[model samples]
Target: MKNALKEIILAAATAAHQKGIFPSSDFCEVVLEEPKADSHGDLSTNMAMQMAKTQRMSPRKIAETLIDHLDDTRGLIDRTEIAGPGFINFFIRPSAWYPVLAAIHEQDDQYGRCDLGKGTRIQIEFVSSNPTGPLHVGHGRGGAVGDSTANILSFCGFDVQKEYYINDSGRQIQTLGMSVYLRGKELLGETVDFPDTCYQGDYIRDLAGELLEREGRELFDKSEAETIMPCARYAAEKITEGMRADLVDFGVTFDQWFSEQSLYDSGKVAGDIRDFKEKGLIYEKDGALWFKTSDYGDEKDRVVVRQNGQTTYFASDITYHKDKFERGFQKVIDVWGADHHGYIPRMKAAVVASGYDRDQFNVLLVQLVNLLRAGQPVAMSTRAGEFVTLSDVVKEVGRDAARFIFLTRHYESSLDFDLELAKQKTNDNPVYYVQYVHARISSIHRKAGSDGLDVSGFAPSDLSALETREDIVLIKALARYPEAVETAGALREPHRITYYLMTLSAAFHTYYNRHRVLCEDDLKLTRARLYLISAVQKVIRNGLALLGVSAPDAM
Candidate 1:
């Protein structure tokens, strides 16, 4: 319907231009959008205002000329009004909205989908936490946002690959190994001093105990240097396994688990530096190799290799991103913590330096999650290993509630997840409220079935029975589902879908309370209402599914 309106206006403008009503006949763009207030109209456009300078006339006069040329002879638009300073508002016929219901019924699960992306290959890397310990609440929030954004893009016709980059070759992994090794020696009653830089998590002790059970007293006899590598490898494997399990419980499964160490093992890091040097983007300074990132808008030049001859993490990141592009991804999106905001400029500079378009690379900065219980902040310390784990949150709140709450806010904004509120079954919980709408509609269908009415098979021809204001408003909300999805996907914001579902649920709840769905005296109205609510049920299910939330028939 939006496309149809834009075409109508564009054709009118072209015809008017050809008839010498305007100076230029080449009007290539037309925007048709919905007005905020219902009284304004169904759709509004400012084509006349845009053409005022080109047509050499007042905006209102041009608007009048375009309106005179508009062909609504097909009964698509009921009326057109000139509002404000030359704004053309289109009021679509109420009967024109009935096709939306038919679309919902026919498309079923695929109703709100659009082919806006046209199958662009995209890679989204998210929640690439170091495998030093269990994932915390912050990682959980990133998981929800990244997973849902990938789902939305895929629904919008993009070929999306979800990936988790493992930081297994960094200093953190070495620290984890030393932590487990010291703990293993301590388990053998050795008087070894543990350093402050070692990981303090109790899981390190658990890994030590497991190693003792497997290798017995031989582990105690090995030198510290020999023990470090084995312990690090074992701890990294175990912790990474736990991370995978937790994500699975949260309903997030990645298409690939990329290793950071692969860049070094495959010589990609050195090869990248050589390529940059060949392009004169690299220079030697004080016995260290520096990349001229400042030329590409970085705060200053960055060292790719230190004076000690070890490559920096930034060097490895550049290589990894280059590998992503070389693998044929047209676009790459990285979801990182808000603290990494300073890293975006350097990364984007690296993309440009590597001969890739800067616009093809994007970083989504996800803010922190502050978990609370009854309005009180929960204390967490990752260094001390006393923080709440993602698995713990999922076990307490359930995956559906946890994910829904995590996605209730925009990724750029901090979220305060209330533990008690999420556990409640009341209307105050948005997930419960939205799920209840689906369940409520399902119950209505069951009631109609028991009353010997074929509600599923009934297709009323005279939808004019749904001419009431509440019925029309509900229909309008239902019709906005596709627009909501398209906007959310285009903006890469999943919170928009949540807001839409909440508004639609509220509208349905109000209408259900005020009106009767199974009217015995008026079977025509009953069938019509049932059909409308059924469409509502399908839309709610589709929206929730995109957010990775469940829509139960009985809640």
Candidate 2:
């Protein structure tokens, strides 16, 4: 209907221009927006004002001329008005919205899916935590955002691959090895001083104990350097496996688990640096190789290789991202902790320095999660291994509640996850509030079916029975599901679907309370309402699926 309205107005403008009544047949962009207030109209556009300068006339006059030429052959627009500043407000016929319900029923799961990405290859790398310890709440939040983002993008017709880049190499792993090694020596009755640089976690001791039992005393008899790598590999492999298991339990499974060591091992890092040097993007200063990041919008130059000849962590990141583009992804999105917010510019610089478009690189900086019981904050520390793991949260609250809660807010904002509220079956709990609508609608269908009404087989002729105010509002909300998904995907904000679900759920609950779907008095109206709510059910299910949450038949 929005597209129809745009066509009608554009046709009118073209007619006006052909008759030489309006100058410049080429006009500015015609954007139709829904007015905030219902009285303003169903949709609004400012094409006349946009064309005022081109037509060399008053916006009001041009609006009037264009309005006069509108054909309305499709009979979609009820009326049109020239409002303040020459805004053309379109009042669409109420009957036009009824078709939305039919469309929803016909499309089903494919209703909200769109082609905004148009099959563009996109890679989303998220929650790439160091394989040194269990995943903390922050990683959980990132996992949710990244997984949902990939889901939404895939729904929007992007060739999406979800990946988790494993930081299995470098200094962190060495420290983890040392931490486990020192703990292993202590387990062997050797008096060794543990350095403060070592990881302080009970899991480290557990890894040491496991290594002692598995490899025995002979392995420990080797030189400390020899034992360090084995311990590091063992602990890293164990921790990474735990992370993968936890993420799967949390309702996120990646398409790939990329190893950071692969870049160095495959010589991609050195080959990439050589290419950069050939392109003159790499330079030397004080015996260190620096990338010309400042020239590509970074705050200053960044060292890819230190004076000691060891590549920095940033070097591997640059290679990884560049490798992402080389692997045929037109766009790369990285989900990182908000603490890495400052690193975005330099990363963007690296992307551009590597000959990729700046717009092709995007980052979602997810803020910390503040877990609470009731209203009080729960204490947590990642280094001390005292923080609540994602697995623990999922076990307590269930995966659906956790994913929905993690996605309740935009990724840039901090989330306050209340264990008590999530467990409650009340309307105050947002996930339950939304899920109940689906369950309630399912109950309605069951009731209608048992009551001898063919609710599932509802075939509509004229939906004039759905002419009530609440009916129109609900139908309009249903009509906007695709818009919500498109906006969420285009803007990279997964919370839009969450907000849409909440609103739709509220509207459905209000309507359900005020009216009866399986009314015995008016059979026609009952079937109409049944079909409408069925569309609602389908949409709710689709939205929850995008967020990786379940829309249960019984909550």
Candidate 3:
């Protein structure tokens, strides 16, 4: 409907231009917005106001001139009015809204899908937690944000590939290995001093026990230094496998699991650095190779390789990002923890230094989740050797609630994920509230079917009976879904979908209470209402899918 209004405004301006009522046929894009007050009409646009200064006319005069030339041959507009300061308010005919139901039924799942991206190749890498520790609540939040953002962008017609970058290299892995090795020594009755630098998680001990069970006593013949890499490899691989399983359970599956070590193993890190050196992007300083990221956008030059001939993590990162663009991706996105906020400039600088536009790379930082029980912060159980792992939360509250709540706010905003609130079945729970809309619509259909009315699909009918205020409100709400999706995709925020779902659900609930759908005296009215709700059902399902949440037919 907004699009329709834009067309009408264009036609009016063009016709006025031809008649010399307006100066030029060329005009700025029409910007329409829902009026805050009910009296302002269904939608209002400031196109006239925007044009007044440029056309050397009063905004009111411009608005009046455009109104005179309104081309509503399709009967889309009931009437138009010039509001204060020359805002053109368009009150659409109630009959104009009837086609939305048919379009919804015709498109069904594809109703909200768009072509805003036009098939641009995009890669989104997220939840790349180090393979040393199990995934915490923060990683879970990052996963949900990434997966849902990918879904939204895909729905908006971007060619999206989800990726998980495994940080299985460098110091962290060695520490994990030492943690496991020291624990293994304890298991073998060796009086080994465990360093404070090693991991303290019980999972490390579990890994050590598993290693002993698999490799046995003979494997311990090697010195501690000799076995560190094997221990590191074992711990990393196992933890990564566990992370993969947990993420799958949380409704996140990446198209790629990129290994940081792969860049090193393929000699890409060395090769890429040499290329940068040749290009003078990298230089030898004090027996260390440094990337001149400061020249691009970074705050200062960063070392890629130290004097010890060991490459820093940034070296592998530079190679990895260059590999991303080389894979034919037009854009690359990463979801990272908020603690990594300062890392953005250097990473963007790396992209610029590596021959890609810095704008081609973007990062979505997910703030830490404040896990609470009821209204109180939940404490990790040290006695039980339990941390607030993502798997633990999912096990306690279920995936739908977890994912939905994780997306209830912008990723950059701190989210208070109340486990107790998530598990509640009442309307206070946003997930349940939105999901009940789907279930209630299904119940409506079930009642219709039980009454011997065919609930399969909607056909063209006299939807004139749907001229009530509640019906119009629902139609408007349904219409906003696609727009919400587009905005969310453009901004890379999936939380907007959650807001839309809640609003749509609230609209449907209001309509449901105010009107009845299966009236015997007015079969036409009943059919119209049923068709409208089926569209609501479809949209709710589609929205829930974007958040990786299920729309259960019955609650």
Best by TM-score: 3
Tell how far residue 361 is off in model 3, in angstroms.
0.6
Each candidate structure's TM-score, on Cα atoms with residue i matched to residue i, is: 0.96, 0.96, 0.97
**For residues 264-329, what per-residue lDDT tens digits would candidate 3 score against the true structure?**
899999899989899989999899999998998788999999999988988899999999999999
Tens digits of per-residue lDDT, candidate 1, 1-555, equal: 787788888888888988988889867478888798988888899988998888888999999998998886567798889999999999888877888888899999999999978999999999999999999999999999999999999999999999999999978888988999999988988888999899998999999999889988787588888888889998999999999999999999999999998889999999999989998999999999999989988999999999999889999999999999999999999999999999999999999998899999998899999999988999998878899999999999899899989999999999999989999999999899999999999998888888887555466584767877778778889988999999998999999999999999999998998889898877788888888999999999999999999999887
lDDT of 2 by residue, 369-460 (tens): 99999999999977566889888899999999999999999989899999999999999999999999999989987877777875444556
- Candidate 3 has its poorest 10 consecutive residues by lDDT at 453-462
Q: Which stretches of candidate 1 lie over 4 Å from their true place?
A: none
Estimate the TM-score for candidate 2.
0.96
Better of 1 and 3 by TM-score: 3
Candidate 2: minimum summed lDDT over ten consecutive residues — where? 453-462
Local distance difference test, candidate 3: 0.91
